[model samples]
Target: MKIEIWSDVMCPFCYIGKRNFEAALAKFPDRDDIEVEWKSFRLDPAMPEVPRYQENMYQFVAARKGISYDQSVAMHEQVARMAENAGLDYQFDKMLVTNSLKAHRIIQMAKTKGLGEKAEERLFYAYFTEGKNLSDDAVLTELGISIGLTATEVKEALTNPVFQHQVEADGAEASRLGAKGVPFFVIDRKYAIAGAQPGTEILKVLQTAYAEWKKDNPGLIHVRQGNTCAPGNDCTN
Candidate 1:
């Protein structure tokens, strides 16, 4: 089964989704048969690179959501606690707010180089936790190299704008499909699951999707070398 996920690195719920989905896969007996692909989505494509003071970021979100500052603070704390419970140290206040269009492109490049999952995680960590500027091509190249791809290769790919169009196309398709928000999952391009749903919920979806795929393939599995990078899945698939 191939699961395609559309999410933005800066979206807190996307980080939660990643953890929840991973936890679900950990409990599966046939985890190795699944292939997960990270699709590009931008939460704030118009945002510019800037050092955001913690309070300002919250204010920005609150203003956009038309919520009270107090409610925004509460939401921040809630997300922080949830992230902590999932073994992620979220530093929302220290985060650097920036556009993610190029970052999504970098993730696409990483996918071509077989570092898609790591790039996905690293991008989330860099944006929401480490306070890195996702809009910066230089920073993205460096991060890609750190994950496995060569820095020169990353630079070349970024300069050539190889995956930028594809990333934008993914976002367009998601919007065309009526996706208002992200952390959305399309299992085998049939079943759709939205938001940072619970691990058990994810498990149910995976099981159902895997069963459906099995029914069609009839005892065949999709396991291949370098399929999807996780704890056990081959990345070649």
Candidate 2:
């Protein structure tokens, strides 16, 4: 079975959802047979490439949603608590606000090398915990190196427009799937789970999908020939 996840690196819920899904999958019996693919989704494609120190994350969120800075801070605090529950330490105060297009493209390049999951994890950690700048080429190059990607490969992917289309395609597919937000999970292209659901809920969905898949595709069947007979010449042959 294949699972495709559409998420943005800057989305706090995406990291939390990833943890919950992993927890559920770890308890699943057929987890070894599952293939996970990470798809790109950008929350703010038009955001400028600036360091978080210039304008903090709270201010950016406040301006974007037309909410007060205090409200944005409160929202971020709530999300931080939720992240702590999921074993993540989110430093929203230090978090940077930048365009994720380059990050998404790097992820797309990592996907080609079968390191998509690693890239996603590293990017989430860098942005949420370390508060690194995602738009900086140097930072991205370091991230790529940490994930076992060659410096040359990372430079090529970042400098050129090689994986831009792949990122755009993933975004387009997310729109077509009617996904209004990040952290959308699709199982076998059949079951859809949105948002950061609980581990128990995710486990139930996984089990249900696996059961249905088994029911639809039973073990292979053998057909017997009527004209060609075995040595015993029995129809059972």
Candidate 3:
């Protein structure tokens, strides 16, 4: 089974959706054979590249939304609590409200080299956990190196904009799929689940996909499915 997920690091639900999808994958009978890809989505195309201070950003965005700063904090608090349940901590305090187009370009490059997932993991954890600047070449290089990519390869990948067209192509594809949000998951390029659904919901989708795959590959042994899981347990559909 091939699962392609479109998500943005800045979106809190993307992290939760990742955990949900992982849970589903853990339960698949053919877990070892499953292929997963993370696609980039920019929630705010016009966003800046610098880090955003919590207080100021909260006030600025909330005022534009006609809500108080406290309301924004409350919303962030809700997402933070959800993240905790998912075994992840989002330091929104350290987040930079920046444009993600360049980040998407890097991901498109990583995909060609079969290092897309590693690069994405690094980018997400760095942004939501360590408060790193995504626009920094040094940080992006470190991310690439952490994924076993050579330093020169990483630098060349970022500097040359080789994947610029690829990123745009992905955006165009997303548009064709009617994707309007991050954390949109497409299974076998047939089924799509939008937003961060719960673990059970994701697992069911995986199970459905597995059934479809079995019809095409008759002899493929499916992974043993377990009892339906809640949030924490792995999903094997």
lDDT winner: 2
Tell me the tens digit of each residue's lDDT in model 3 across 1-237.
788888887677987888877877777667787788888777777766754543354665676678888998898788889989988988877776666766676677778789888777777888788877777778777777787777787666666755766666666788789898878998898899999898888888888887898798888764666767678886655
Quote each prediction's TM-score.
0.86, 0.89, 0.85
Model 2 spans with C-alpha error above 4 angstroms: 51-54, 220-237
lDDT of 1 by residue, 34-97 (tens): 8988899987776666534433668777887899978988999999999988889998787766
Best by TM-score: 2
lDDT of candidates 1 onward, in order:
0.83, 0.89, 0.77
Candidate 3: misplaced stretches above 4 Å?
Answer: 51-57, 219-237
Comparing 1 and 3 by TM-score, which wins?
1
Q: Rank the candidates by TM-score, best first.
A: 2, 1, 3
Residues 39-67, model 2: lDDT tens digits: 99988776778744334988888887899
Q: 108, model 1: CA deviation in Å? A: 1.0
Report the alpha-carbon TM-score of model 1 versus the true structure. Answer: 0.86
Name model 1 segments beyond 4 Å from true.
51-55, 219-237
> Which window of ten consecutive residues has the lowest lDDT sum in model 3?
51-60
